[model samples]
Target: MHDIAPYLLQNDLGGESLVEFEHEEGWDLIVVNLARAIDRHVRHQAKIDPESYDLDLIYFSQVKEKKGSLRAYVTMPDAIINAYVDFAELMSETTCEVTGRPGLLHTKMGFVKTLHPDVAAERGFKPVD
Candidate 1:
């Protein structure tokens, strides 16, 4: 997986705490795609009016997998950026976090994860009831 931090313009690493990705490797592609979209969006807005969508106005504070879906904690406030995050979360729920294959939520014991059927079988996970 490629390092996504470089794509983020203002990740706000100085004041608070360092942001990090806590999801699986397969989801790295999803994050990369999202980062590019946000970068492009910010750049476009900067062209129109620099203050309209400044880079520092939004960024992910935390990214993690929870309950067979992606959870992104973004800082600052921006509706467009929030919508991008929402779409990414939806993609993560249907894509395997380990293999990037189309997937569904499965369970092993009490732990739930989004995984393809073959991968789930290999991991001893059962279909969610």
Candidate 2:
């Protein structure tokens, strides 16, 4: 079975350390869930009356009204593109590189899931297929 990384669903980095190579400029954050990117979310804006409200209230209200963000899309690595196509017989939900833990698909925000070579092997995943 494919092994997902611990805290793959968490808001933080979970347990994995950041890798320098994985760090892309302007993308300091990694997305934790690929589903979140694919999931439909409505973009919204808030109307505020600054003159009628305190600074803190206006700030907090704006924060609460914010919606989820999309994942950063970058070119996939050769190994990862081949791996996902080979193992799942479909395009990957995201791309990733190895860190302290096993390599995993990710967004700029965080990890979505771990890619275990053993799982691919057991499933007879071929690069071409």
Cα RMSD to native, each candidate?
Answer: 2.7, 16.5
So what's the TM-score on candidate 2? 0.19
Q: Candidate 1: TM-score?
A: 0.83
lDDT of 2 by residue, 15-110 (tens): 232322233221122322222221211011112433432212111000000011122321221343234223321222222122222333322233
Off by over 4 Å in 1: 1-17
Instruction: List ranges where model 2 is wrong by over 4 Å.
Output: 1-115
Alpha-carbon local distance difference test for all models: 0.78, 0.24
Which residue pairs come into collision in candidate 1?
none
> Residue 103 CA error for candidate 2 (Å)?
6.8
